[model samples]
Structures are given as structure tokens and as C-alpha cells.
Target: MSQIIDTSSRAHLLDLFLGLRPDTLSLWGKMEPQQMVEHLIDQVQYTNGKKIPFLEFSEEEAKLAKQKNIYTDLKIPKNVIFGTLPDQLIYPDLPSAIKQLMTELDDFDLYFRNPETTAIHGAFGPMNYKEWIIWHSKHFTHHLSQFGLIAMT
Candidate 1:
């Protein structure tokens, strides 16, 4: 699996994100181009422990998700809702959203460097840096494919 925490992988992901134009259409999801960028930034923030999730799964559910290694999975189920995104995160344009996402990506990189830091995913429960990296890679790929930025094999 490609890991997003690696510099080269991050660069590749960034390239795909930058390749998106304002009119890029989603292949699956409902998100527009700017909304997709915002969504990705929110994903990064969730991983970095900068934003708390609204999801409150039952103890048993959390345990099951952890046991299943949900986030680490290469492909997530499509059309799964990720809770509500903050209204403030909605950017005025794709370029602005992309720029903010780039900043968040940098923040995620710094956060990942500290092995001690771990974030609790809403569905996946608490995750270490390695787990976060894996999740982000899969998550990014999923959305990138939605925008036709990459293809899933």
C-alpha cells in the first residue's frame, strides 16, 4: 500500500490534487471540486487531532471497527457519511481550498513525525501515527478517484 506519510507519496498525492480544475466532476460522490478539497483538509485535520469528530459509536461498534482494521483497508465502502463538516471549512473557491489543504498537509507531516501522538478516529477509534498514515492514503485515493485524479486498481 502506498503510504501518505512518505515525502514522495505526499508529493504524488499533491500533484493529483493540483491537477484538479474548477469544473472537475466527481465520478461517485456528491462533492464538488472545492468541497472535495475541503473534505480532504478535514480528513487531515481529523488525523492530526486538530478537529474532533462528531461520530459517537457504541463501545462494541468501536471495538468491531478496530478489529476489522477499517481505516487500514485499501478500499472503503462508497457513500459512507463521515459526519458533518464545519460550515466554516467551505472555501470560496477551489484554489483557496487547495491552498488550505496544502497547509493542512504540512501540518499533518509535522504531526506524523511525533510517534507519541495518536488520534481517535470516529469509526476506527484511537490510532497511532502509522495507522493514520495508512488511513489517509486510502482515504485520499478514494476521493482522488472520485475526481478522476487517479484510478483504483
Candidate 2:
């Protein structure tokens, strides 16, 4: 079974982000390094208090989708467009954007400590803390691979 490198390995993960250069190239997709980092930060906010109301599937469909996503080894498909974020560059640079992403990740952990709290995902419907973490790991792995920082085997 192929396993994702979990985001809990924060130090190593941060190293990959820190290594991104201004001229880094993506294997696919149009997002620049800083833009991608900001994009990830926006997505991570979905687990905290961000209220995204879109759902890609019905309750039963989302349930099945969630099962396949979280319990199985499905990698998040690549080359997806995000309509939520504008063409704006939110952070001054890649390192700063990555730093902000880590802050949001820390907030995600704290936000879900109540356990009773859940957040909506446009595709997966609602998920608790642990589910979000797994999803985030997969999400991060996908983007990291896009930059050739890691390979999926």
C-alpha cells in the first residue's frame, strides 16, 4: 500500500517549503510557489472556521467519497482549478506564505479540540479534526509533488 508522508512531520515538511526558490517550476498547474502556498493556507482554513457552503455530492455520495478518501490511498487529483481565490498574491513571498500556512495548521488543531465541532468540505461534506488532518496530509503531498519536492511511489 502506498502511504502519504503525513504533515505531522512538520520540521521536514517545512524544510521542503523553505527550499522553494522564486523561480521554482511546477511539474503541472499554473500556481506559482507563493501562490500555491497561499492556496494551501486557504484550503486549510476549511477545517477551522471557514464557511464554504459548496458540496460536490449528496449526503450518501459524500459519505462514500469520504470513506474512499480518508480510509483508502486515493491521491487528490492534480491540475484542479480553485475559483475561490482570486489572482491576488496575498503574501509578500513564499517563505512568509508557508509560515502563515503553518500558523493556520496550528489553529486547525486547536479549533477541533472540542471534537464535537465539525467543518464543511466542498467535496467531502462535513469532517471532524482527524479526518481533516488526513485530508490535509494528502492535500499537502499533492502540492509538494507538484513542485518535485517529493515523489509518490
TM-score per candidate, chains pooled: 0.81, 0.89
- In order, what lDDT does every prediction score? 0.72, 0.82
Where is model 1 more than 4 Å wrong at Cα? 1-8, 70-74, 83-89
Clashing pairs for model 2 are: none
> What tens digits encode model 1's per-residue C-alpha lDDT throughout 1-153?
442323227676667878999898878767778877888887788866588764468767876876676444446666777676455547778878888888887887787787787778787677777777667777777777777777665
Regions more than 4 Å wrong, model 2:
1-3, 50-56, 82-85
lDDT of 2: 0.82
Top model by TM-score, which number? 2
Worst 10 residues of 2 by lDDT: 46-55
For candidate 2, what is the TM-score?
A: 0.89
* Residue 142's lDDT in candidate 2: 88
- Model 2 per-residue lDDT tens digits across residues 33-152: 887898888888877675455777898899888999988888878888757546689888777888998888888878888979888887788888788878888988888888888886
TM-score computed on alpha carbons, candidate 1: 0.81
Error of 2 at 12 (Å): 2.1
